[model samples]
Target: MWDHCPLMLMRKNFVSFHVNLVFFQVEDAQGREATIQRLADSIAGPFVYSVMTLSAITFGFWYYFGSHIFPDVLLNDIAGSEGDPLLLSLKLAVDVLVVSCPCALGLATPTAILVGTSLGARQGLLIRGGDVLERLASVDHVMLDKTGTLTEGKPAVSAIMSLACEELEILQIAAAVEKTASHPIAHAIISKAESLNLSIPVTRGQLAEPGSGTMAEVNGLLVAVGKLKWVQERFQQKTDLSDLTTLEQSVMHKSLQDSQSSNHSTTVVFVGREGEGVIGAISISDKLREDAECTIRSLQHKGIETILLSGDREEAVATLAKTVGIKDKFVNASLTPQQKSAAISGLQALGHRVAMVGDGINDAPSLALADVGIALQVEGQETAASNAASIVLLGNRLSQVLDALDLARATMAKVHQNLSWAVAYNVVAIPIAAGVLLPNSDFAMTPSLSGIQELSGYGTQKVTSVDLVKLEMTDFDVILGMDWLYSAMPQSTAEIELSSFSSQMSLF
Candidate 1:
């Protein structure tokens, strides 16, 4: 009895297992079919309307005109008695008119550009429009100089050593006077003060001398901060004839001459009290960004040739470029804005699309000349460059350059996809329109021609719709504009996410 009971339980368990397997198999098969059906429906939904509209227009023309008017026109007496030479000519003219290129030249190029620009914007790269974006993407060689493009434009006080007074006190007084000035040097001074946690006194009155420094009233003291010569001159005017020793007079006189020559090259800050002598001097230097080397390598990895053009001395430019691992090409030693422009034009004349990245007033001309001009966000001439440039990188980080390049490449790929679709559609449709596959073919124009006509119209209409979506994404309502996103994320992640989002939005 026990043996029989065990056998019955085993048989019951086997039957239950078999029943569950059958149920699951049925459910799995149904789920798979449902998935396939959903996919088909989703794809067919948009295309159905496209095909229907195209078919209606094509058939309407063929039935109302092709069947009624065209054959009659072909057989008319005006056709020279159904075979006259003049009538044949007239018929040919009509056929030619009907087949005249429907692809509007004015509309096609602009539409492509509109699509490309929208795609670029979605990738966190704000391109002005079609003309500029096309030109930028086509660029081959890029010339990027180290200084401001690959370095922080703000030159900090690297080593503020005091010659006469307390170093911190000198920085504090200078920062106070500079608080009222708008020069880069002034900003560097204030930044240094803040870093040192020194409290700078509020300025009462301030006056800036172009190419020199500034003079101001801080905490009820007449503080003059400028080149040594200017400060010495101010002190000389206020002091008596014998206030200074012979050595002091000689040093002051020599400093003034040197100041005049060095004014264009170096920035020197001299701080002193009213009717008194010089206290201390602070020298600041612009340092390259920490990631400049890595950024250059990233560009090289993408097969883009990097070159540097700078107004700085040749030795300095070479040193900087080499430090950043970009030593193959560099033009140095104080190039004028026109010279920079000429260099860009010359490179472009060689059939290379040149991209110039710069951050100075002198760089504006070159930026305009280059195929694609990129300006760093903190650059002093960012506004002018941004207006002229095809792209603008908004951040102090040099690595942002790599991000911009990746975005450009991806945007170009999307443009290529669009171009390919346009060409492929034409290749397949033109032969059918010419009636190439007509006689003795069951698979005739009735189905495929209708499909072609519908597809073309559908594509054209969808382009317009997609363009609107792109415009909304690119031209989103915001003050800071597209830069906010690029500023917030790493260049790589931002670009990848942007590309994915754009592709999805375009339904590519």
Candidate 2:
């Protein structure tokens, strides 16, 4: 009754082809009817029909030979009748083909990655994919290089000293001479002048030398502002040093001492009647971020280890770290870029997952070398590092790092939940597929048994022999991804929670 079964196979293949076409059509029908209709029309065309007919014919031939001709041939061979040995080999080959398909492993891994990446996007952290997220979550320690990372990149005048003049007068003269300069020290002087509401007198023929203070005519006075050395040198060249007072000597001595201690290449000024006597000096240094202490403490509470890596002096780095509550485990005092990368690699080699957060070109190599790299957006030097980083913080606030860490932890948790559900499904479905509990009279597992058996045998059975039937009853509900998580919750609320928790700890 089953002989000449090409029509039956054709009917089965026709149904399968339509079922797949319908499944794709439904998925593609994302509020776009015209596009979906075009896709559906393509699936119903001659090319699809031809492929289905060919597949049906191939399946029919394999079934016919397996149930009839091959078995008869094997039996005749055992009974010593003349039968084809090649026919038995072909039948065995067909039987093996019927039991193994390659779709299972091919479909599973990519699907898992897709789901993981989609979930990560919902958390406001866009990782390239699951592989990147997995790598980010595993970071055990973070090396935050100083300079632009821990402090404002710009330097401003923090302190100023004067003797024979008001502080505002000293700032005004300094700002007038330093106005045309682009150096950080110059900016600091100008900023001080602005804050004090000091009017900078416009200077004519302003000249600035590397080690010499800037010289300008402010209100027709030869105004000079820089190191005492430059001022004294210019002064002695044209003045009578024998007439200098004790108080002038003391002020100049203190200015010299400050210059040496600061290690700042100083520029001194000689303000006189057509350049005869020296007047004053101004010093500048880089400013630390106002929220540095708060940011450091927040990082500690999240269980993220922090280390400062910098090219600044050991004393300076230590002082800042101590002020910010960061520990003494930091690297300080003029580290080369190669040394930074080596340090990161060393930590990684010891089985510590290191994240290097930086905002400088000097950090690019180390950022690339670390397990996870984070770059802040506001720093211009961060461009190269940002490109290399697995994550880029859009704002200058270190609190954003805390935000990302929270989101990453949340994303990872969701990944675990998804993995657990997927594993559980397989564990429960596999046994029922193998008929482990079907014989028990207490529970009738038979109705579910057929579906489970078919699912389990998906790759084990011939792709053509397995009925391509849709089992809507067995489909699991859609699991939430990271996008859904973000839309459902308030990010501001999360930030507030983090802030409150941080205050309670005071670890920073």
Candidate 3:
């Protein structure tokens, strides 16, 4: 927690003479709902109050004076009995004040948002605010990064092409230099070296180039492990592998031995030494998520354009795109974070709302730039993607994206319903309370009746239709949600549940 963020105690729990307290505050939060409600209150508050006062005065004068002037038309048993004109006027004026409540207009949105956000929190969805929810509901194009998103983010070493160098030596140096990198491919190389029981050397002054690779000093020698072009530039050598020597005895280099059965999806990186030039190439492969294709299908079925963004080989990205049902034209490969952000901006410029989803540092810029950013939560890793994103999925399930879309849609629906009802009630209730129906139907609203109806609307909003329903227990759960869960946007597409982080402006 930052020094500025002081926790405001909400509640405390007891266990074995120990106290565990949970502290969270969502009031006065700055988001779509809060902004809209404040705006609505500023204008609607005075407007309703002024209108009520004016209407009361108008009705009061008409009853007190007009009753005597036109007894046959005004003096009726509908509202007030034949009594002192001042007393009769006072009762009707008070009725006008009671009927014109600011709740239906002001309270509608905030209340709905509160319920929606709280429900999302309990379900493991940390939605940032009503603004993120509104934007998520409007996203027509979903841009998903390949690693840790479309794929499992668990790459494994498949082949190593050493040029006149021992395979184990190449792997050892590659793993040693790549040890400082956090990328899944780096993990793959290091894990392979460890499985082979190779003694890995420590490196210092590591420089990581996003979407390219890493370079470091290993035992006084500057070695580079990444893309061929980048590694060649770091080694000051030529980027050419066509003039490589024969490798006829290797079984792991099946792509070279039997070209017919080669895996095209494998990502290959060059390993180079300070003076040895390009020494070898390490090939790695990560499998696509089991739900990747289905999740893409679901988005497509709901009329969302699923686009693939990756910093991998074009062929690999295109192949994954084909498998996941995203069109070839929508696939962006070998792109850095800036390029990814440009891709999002381009789509946004074209008036298409884009939602970027990823789980790496490279995806952070695009995630924050998109209309809504969705990030997957890796249990142990504190990812930059999670920090920048507006929505974070706790589990490694692709379908959670759709679940989030569903939640956004559902939450907005509740907001619209509340606002609509509030507007309609004000429109009808105010007119009737002003004695608009007294002339023809002999019906007039009383102060007590106006108060009852206004209070009923609020009472009805307190409970959900499925409130207090029983469900079987599966696992232990504890949750806290504050005022959130509201949006006024049109939600006709898919939505999901997500929780937000620092963007929430809880003053505690």
The TM-score values for the models, in the order shown, are: 0.52, 0.46, 0.81
Query: What order do you get sorting by TM-score, best first?
Result: 3, 1, 2
lDDT of model 3, residue 100: 71
Q: Which candidate wins on lDDT?
A: 3
Off by over 4 Å in 1: 1-112, 145-148, 153-155, 161-185, 193-281, 285-290, 311-316, 328-342, 345-351, 360-362, 378-388, 395-397, 410-424, 440-443, 447-452, 456-508
The Cα local distance difference test for each model comes to 0.54, 0.51, 0.69
> 243-267 in candidate 2: lDDT tens per residue?
3343344444555565434322222
Candidate 3 versus the native: TM-score? 0.81
Off by over 4 Å in 2: 1-128, 157-287, 379-382, 442-508
Which candidate, 1 or 2, would have the higher lDDT against the true structure? Answer: 1
Better of 1 and 3 by TM-score: 3
| Superposition error at 52 for model 3 (Å) | 3.4
Q: Tens digit of lDDT per residue, candidate 3, span 1-508?
A: 6769767876633321111110022222223464456666776768776866767675666566655764543455533465455555565677777877676667666655665554554444557777777788778999999988888888778777788589898899999988878888899999999999999998899888888888888889998888766777886666355643232123235544434333234577878888878788777767778778899999999999988888886877887789888998888898878899999999999999999999888888999999999988654345888779887765556777887787677666666676667677777877777666665776766678888877765544433211211212111132212112222111211122111211221211
